[model samples]
Target: MSADTQHSSQFALLRQRRFAPFFWTQFLGAGNDNLFKFAFTVLVTYQLQVSWLPGEMAGLVIGALFILPFLLFSATSGQLADKHDKATLIRGLKLLEVAVMVLAAWGFHAQQVPLLLACIFLMGLQSAVFGPVKYAYLPQHLNERELTGGNGMVEMGTFVAILLGNVAGGLLIAIPEVGARWVAWSCIGLALLGWLASLKVPASPSTDPALVINWNPVSETWRNLKLASESKSVFRSILGISWMWFVGAVFLSQFPAFAKDVLHGDEQVASLLLVVFSVGIATGSLLCETLSRRHVEIGLVPVGAIGMSVFAVDLYFASRGLGGGAAYTLAGFVERAAHWRVMIDLALLAFSAGIYSVPMYALIQLRSPASHRARIIAANNILNALFMIASAVLGGALLQLGLTIPQVFLAVGLLNVVVGFYIFLLVPEYLLRFVALIASRCIYRFKVRGDEHIPVQGAAILVANHVSFVDAILLMAASPRPIVFIMDHRIFRIPVLGWLFKLAKAIPIASQKDDPATYERAFAEAERVLRDGDLLCIFPEGAITRDGTLQEFKGGIMKILEQQPVPVVPVALQNLWGSFFSRIEQGTAMVRPFRRGLFSRVGLVAGAAVAPENVSPAGLRERVEQLLAA
Candidate 1:
């Protein structure tokens, strides 16, 4: 097969039985939701008038009703996911959606406000319960390498559905000729299609069959949240995801008003705004999958958050001095090229959101235990709902305090900066990932071959031929798992490099001739780390080579093998020697200045892992030589 076809095959899951059905099922459900919500909203705003609940308050009321189910039912929903078959439960939810749409159809035809509100609440309940199941199902099916791409696809599908659903809703309801009849039937048809699709999704067996179902909403919600907080990284990740939701809720709420009051455009303009945002996000999500080399790189979250703030602030300024009055038609809105900057800002904001969100979902799946993974996902849903509601309340409070719409956008942007920095600080792994990601993107076009050799989940010792100072960094960049390197103790004392070494969790060893205790300590730590099912990388050569050549493999690797009989993966670093970090002396300097320019291409070859019985210092070195030859 061609390389193009081979690369694109990473998304083979989307075409497979395991993933495709679930994808379409959720896609149709999301689209149907927006169809019903917007159809009824337009019905109230344009055709009907009630004293108790004014048309102006429809958006808030609908938003509240939808979010309420997530807050109330998610705790119980988590228990259901962990204790029963996910496919069956998901199918049941789709059937419930069909029933809800039946009610929605009647409400739309009869123009009954109470029945319509009930349908909204029921739709929210379906979404709330499915949230945990939707996210938790990915990790159970896909391999670790496929998780990032799978998530990117799912995220892209969801936003595309949203964009299409809103457009369909607007077209069906707002057009006087077609009106409510078309929208009502469309929603019902969509729901039924979702149910049919759900039937094809493969069964996902429960992890905790004996888990007692938690029935109390209030206390069970707290218990589920506490379970999520058990791991610091997991908890912080939940916070990060929730914060992004809050930011998104704020922006999604403002688009209609922003289009009419700020951009002076009608329904078409609002749809256009959503279109740009959704397309940008979809593009960004796929871009993240490509950039990370299909790894769950948490560093992109920080990148996304920073980009969100920058674009949002720019959006506020772009709207400055632009006068708002009579609504602009679609043709007129597109005529002025200057108005495009505002669209650009909106697109970039959503683009950043795509980057920020995909990795976070993958992280939650990767880190959370399979036994309670669904419950953890449930906790995330609850937090997202609360944060979204808080976003609404906060925006209201700020606007009441005399802030303009553009000013509110500015405030949300600033808050993103503060929230992002706090989360990064809370988890330094994300910060290290930031450094690793930037280094790979800017300093070098780091490439890895034979990454499939790295085991997805197991204890493995990586035996690598280290060519330069940044060998570990380059290897870590290519690896899907966090690798702990065993390095010389003196390297851990090199000022800033030492600080970074500790952050990367490198194991520092000393020569027995110099410090026997440190040398023994390194072996003990290696044993412990491997026992915990983590990857450990060691340079088989005792020292960095003075020339661009391989050295004899040392005996220390045998010592690690003796302590723990984990598999050994031989790795080779290609094109890194003679670089600045390598011990290639130039003139009077040990390391030359700018010998190799920025973004230099380098290769890392991960050879297949050898069983512990076949591993030897010389055998591993020969394996490294064979990989280098390839």
Candidate 2:
């Protein structure tokens, strides 16, 4: 591809007119939400110091207020998103933000507690209504390949906004010259800015304009949840996502208190903690785009979960030595013993959170059915609200039961490990992708070539030279599709490794001369897999190389193609001959124990597919040899 025609960067979308406006519009909106909320929190906790609700319980109440609208209105909002043009919805939402800010400004001027709480709930409502419109608009604008990058940018923006807004709210309210007025007016102006940005966002057509609106929150929410639950994987992913919210809510809601009671730090120090955490999240989120090669890689989900759990556990240890009533400023907090460890723990925890979240959102976008996608997102929002609320209730319960903040952190971290293990066990593909991601990125140095020759969609026969036992896993790591490999039945009995292949659903092919029934049954299974529109990979060599030389292609390729008539793609693996799986010593390949040093260079080359009618045994061998040579 020419430089002019190729995409420059995943972030290059931000420079384009199609995506830039909406990005800024939403960015400003998220910033405004946090700014207003925190400014109010500062007013209540620091200045007013209300006695009616103790400081410890105040965060729970405010957080519950903020997310309440999500539980109540997510379903109706989803219907609106589907029933109206997204750009129009964005414009309307921005206008609503303006009106809400006016109310917020009025409440701030009067120092009315009821009105401020109402404003917080209004902000939550704004966020809830925008949820479906926020995500569903992406697929409408970008191609499938762009979705991961686009979501990454969105996550980066949200976390950055959260950081900036919290910083602004935390700082501005403390300044006597600025106080609530400056905060309120700044929010008003930001809302107007968001509205202007929304005006420039191009129209994104609704997915289901003809659908009737469901006003009943109870039944509609249930219906949306049911829609999301129809797909088992997506549903489990939704649960995973909600659990993320739960973990997040507990951690974030405690920072203000944690900074005071545990770290002996002031409000500025708490704000700095949030700032550090948000920065970590933004960094990890952007890194996910690069790490996954801009795909919805479920593997990163487990990796992220692992990091989050480990760091969260460490956070408890880091914060254990807080001597209460010391009164440390931000700089003093840093000067204290082991305090730097706390910041590192918070940063890594949020960083892993960013890595964990982006891929899951992309997975949802790719997995969801288009017609009901908005409702699915709405269901996700509802569940998110529920989980967050539960976090508050459950966390308050834990605190009441005499658990310290560190103990709570320890418990949550351990719980994360359990949940992550459970999810990965239920879906091994995530674990496989994690393995593949590690292999490609860190283990063997792989250089893939001629990947463009492989068709992006539809059934095809992938005939590769099986130079190493690791060939199938390596190819799967490289290819976007899930490939079902045809392996020798004996190899499938190799204890642990064999069990993994069986779990991967690799077809066990036997040599017809030795076992006719098994051979015939394998062919029948291959046909069934292809007919189901899945990718099928076969080693036409019928065995790995005894020596590092190209073997003559067996006739199985022709036989399968005759039965299935799928396009045949020829692939070659080079420079893997001396690997432990290869027959480097020639005798007893499995027992010989031979391998290239770590980080050995390896290459995989693919050739254009040959039509089923055009492919012959000799021609296919020539193609494979040509690829290997190239």
Candidate 3:
């Protein structure tokens, strides 16, 4: 089949039943999270008269209950996911959700606030355990090409769920007849529905069946966290994801107060702020697939962070003009729509969050080893939980120390700038891209075709002919998204290029004898990248051609294909041979005088995609040769 047709066919598979059920299950999980929390917040703020615990303290308690599970159970969940059938594990978790809901019902009926909070904590436990399985299950069901779109849909669904759930929770609790009980019952129903959906998921074979389960939460958590930190890109991605949670936790925790004191809105209006935020996240999540053009583009992370800071600072000013104690009904909110600045802040915040999170999720997935992919994800959850908890404490402390909610928003927003700058500085790959992008426009003219062969957004494997040492950099520069290159371990150690590749999060592999473990790790990392919907680029020939001609494809690509049949976009780098970095005249140094005006024409020819069925080492080599010849 033609590459275009092949690419389209692979994407269609993602919409099928085997994948959709699991997607919905995760979607509902996120939705239920917000739904229950919103309901609890309403209960604390309006129904319960707690003179002992201040409002901010109550908010902190709710936040803690939700995050505590990640700290306690995420490590164990990762082991469970690696050792068991993911489908069965997910179904079991769903059943546990039912019991948790029953406990929630008891809390609502008894008017026992602490019991309700305990139930929330239990719910967080269930979610924390489910986190690893949610991520690990994807590579089992999806092809590489579909990973990005699949992840994008899940993220989008999650935010949509958050929006709907928050809205429902608020509306349900405000009802006069059965406020708290009604919300509890609704949560229960949703949990059951999530279980039903999970039942439809196909069985997923364990990658590590003999893995010993670690029972001790603290030590196991530390071990998993260390595993995540071992890889540079994986480590940075975790930090990026954790920072997002930190920023989000701060903003979300303060929204109720912001709406009440600043916007002068009641419970309904406060909920609307959440709704706007969730809507923005949903919008951004959906747009990720398009904006990234289906590749893992970390550049978008910076873009998202910038928006987050800008809008957050603007929100403080926006609140200044909102006046005080001006409550509005649902209908009144529409009538007095002059408070649209709040809407802008909410939308931008969510949108930036979407941009920031999609790539980080993709990056972690791409950079982690498959054998321990879920564990790494669990580690990420652990850190996310920790950061979120800290955000709550920090935000609360600031407020108690006499900072207004709007001022807290400004502080967090400003802090985001500092944090973002620090991360970029530490990992200059993002900065290099900005430099490369500017350089590409000025140095050499280039064009990309058949970019559609790449997924509109999600995981894909880019197979390019390696004509020069800078093949990966050139591809990274040409493509709109970030490309995770699989490199010779030796190339990864090159002085300047090595550091650049490290910063770019390139995966380095070696032959079995040199390092069998590293070789296995390379493929495992590639699998994770595919699972996260990030781009994985490998020189199928395994090394750059000495004579600027495509070589035979290597079986490593085949091994990756076996694990995940992601769409493979064949890229040919044309006319880059005579450049300064190119291997001109058997690699004799061309370093000094020729470097200044040594600009050369470069062309990135993106041929149609090749499906897994159509790809073999021989066939892929021949196909790449043809593209290069063109």
Q: What is the C-alpha local distance difference test score of each model? A: 0.85, 0.85, 0.79
Give the clash count for each candidate.
Answer: 0, 0, 13
Q: What lDDT does model 2 reach?
A: 0.85
TM-score per candidate, chains pooled = 0.93, 0.94, 0.76
Task: Please tell me which predicted candidate would have the highest TM-score against the true structure.
Answer: 2
Candidate 1 residues lying further than 4 Å off, grouped into runs, are 1-11, 41-58, 586-593
- Residue pairs in clash, model 1: none
Lowest lDDT 10-mer window, candidate 3?
1-10
Better of 2 and 3 by lDDT: 2
Candidate no. 1 TM-score:
0.93
The sequence of per-residue lDDT tens digits that candidate 1 reaches over residues 1-630 is: 344433554467677888999999999998898778766765665467877665545555677778889999999999899888999999999999999898888888887899999989999999999998999888888766678888898888888988888778866887785578798899999999999999999999998999998698999999999999998888899999999989987877666667767788877777788789888898888777787888888878889999999999999999887776677988889887868999999999999999999998898899889999999999999999999888878876776687877899999999899999999888877877877888778888788899878876789999889787778777778777678899988878777667888888788998998999999999999999999898999998977777778899999988888889999999998888777778765422225557898888888899888999988888888999998888
Off by over 4 Å in 3: 1-14, 336-338, 433-474, 478-603, 606-629
- Candidate rank order under TM-score: 2, 1, 3
User: In model 2, what is the error at residue 92, expressed in angstroms?
Assistant: 1.0
Write one digit per residue (lDDT tens) for candidate 2, span 194-288.
Answer: 99999999998878989999899999999999999887668888888999999998988888878878887888998999999999999988887
Report the lDDT of model 1 for residue 302.
Answer: 87
